[model samples]
Target: MFEHIDFNNLLATYGYLAVFIGCLLEGETILILGGVAAHQQALHLPLVIFWASLGGMLGDQALFWIGRYFGARLLPRLHRQQAAIERVTGLIHRHPLTSIFSVRFLYGMRLVGPMVIGASRLSPLRFSLMNLLGALVWAALFASAGYWAGQFLESLLGDLKPYRLPIAVGVVIVVGGIALARHLRAKAKEQHKA
Candidate 1:
């Protein structure tokens, strides 16, 4: 049933939208996939970066706005996050610009940091500017990582054409596993708290 689908064609047709939406939901892996597609000439690298950057910035921006408007009411529900929240708040107090600019690069903080900043009542314009800059850098780094990884793998394997489906499937599985793990951990924490 799966044999008919051409991964390259799929990527070429919907790669940009996939990258944008993926970055919006969970960034790094999707950007890397986009880069891999670009390396294959199924998609353009610059446009991948562009879509990634835009999606990343808009995602953070949305989180920031959410924080600004509803954070006070919303934060109390996330009791398990007190420590991380406090740490982000402290970072915002001490190094707001750095925190904002570097937030996306930080592991768990990619999503939370912007919210913390917004909740802190930091300037919206400032967040937007730094978020834009950070998204560009973050997108470039991850996308290039994907592209270069393909290069390295090609050097090692002698051919990538046959491995495209496996590579994509592997990426999806790994990303899904990580996400599931995080979700389970959060649920565990919630249950433990209860």
Candidate 2:
């Protein structure tokens, strides 16, 4: 089943969609992969960044509205995230603008930060503006990092065409493993807190 599909062609055609969708949820890995693809000329760097930023901003905006309209009802259902919610809430209170702009850069806070702010008394316009700025900066930074890594790997390998597939697979496996480990650790911590 996998052999019939050309991975490179698929990425070239649908890379932006992948980046957009991936960034809509948890996105670092996807954006990095896209950046690597761009470095390999499988995708355009600027378009990748644009789609990623849009997706990131839209995702946060949706979560913000959800929190604004349904936070009270949503809170009890998010018992596992109670600690995170509280922390973000406090940050928003103390430093509303900074917190809004910096949350994307902070680990474990990406999803919850905007929600917490929306649930607060912060203005919608303010959140939107800051969210856009943050998303763009975050997208550029991560994507560039991935591109740089690809460049370094290419230089180290001396020639990448012969090993591109294997190298891509290896990178994916390593990143996936790391993400899974982090997720498990976070879950364990949440359970311990509970």
Candidate 3:
């Protein structure tokens, strides 16, 4: 199934679009993949960062507004996120700026953090500025890691042409594994509490 797709062509045609959409809804993997493509000269690094940041900021902002307008109505539907929301709410009350800036860095808090802040008294302007900064930093950090990984692999393997798919698969597997582990741990904790 993977052998037929032309990655170079795909990246050339839909790279930015993919980055934007990906970042709009869970973007770390896409950003890292874009960075790798940049290193391979399939996409531009700066463009990748721009699209990723824009997407990330837009996504968070949308969620923020949703929480702002309908938080009370939405809260009950997000039972799994209650704990994270409460944690972020406390942080927002105590250190609003820091909470806004650092929320993107937290593993499970990325989505809920903005919502909780929006449900709080933080202004849209404040959230926008902080979200932009956080998105940029997150994009740059992850993209650079992807680029560096490509470089390291190139140095080690001597040619990345043949190994790109394998490397991509490896990254996906590792990330998916981590996500799965976290999900299971959270589920187990929920069961224990129950």
Against the reference, the lDDT scores of all candidates come to 0.86, 0.85, 0.87
Q: How many clashes does each candidate structure show, in the order listed?
A: 0, 0, 0
- Write down the TM-score of every candidate: 0.88, 0.88, 0.93
| Model 1 lDDT tens row, 1-194 | 56787777788789999999989977888888888888878888999999999999999999999999988998777776665678789889899999998988765677777888899999999999999999999999999988987888778887787788888888778878987897787668768877
- lDDT of candidate 2 over 1-194, digit per residue (tens): 45566777888788899999999997888898888888888888999899999999999999899889988788668876777788888889889999999988877788877878888958999999999999999999989987888899888986555566676687679888986897888889878876
With a 3 Å backbone cut-off (N, CA, C), the pairs that clash in candidate 1 are none
Question: How many backbone collisions does model 3 have?
Answer: 0
After TM-score superposition, the amount by which residue 26's alpha carbon in candidate 3 deviates from its true location, in angstroms, is: 0.4
RMSD of each: 2.9, 2.3, 1.6
Indicate whether candidate 1 or candidate 2 has the larger lDDT.
Answer: 1
lDDT of 1 at 187: 68
**TM-score attained by model 1:** 0.88
Worst 10 residues of 3 by lDDT: 159-168
Q: Which residue segments of model 2 deviate by more than 4 Å? A: 1-4, 159-165, 180-194
How far residue 4's Cα lies from its native spot in candidate 3, in Å, is: 4.5
What clash pairs does model 3 have?
Answer: none
Q: How many backbone clashes does candidate 1 have?
A: 0
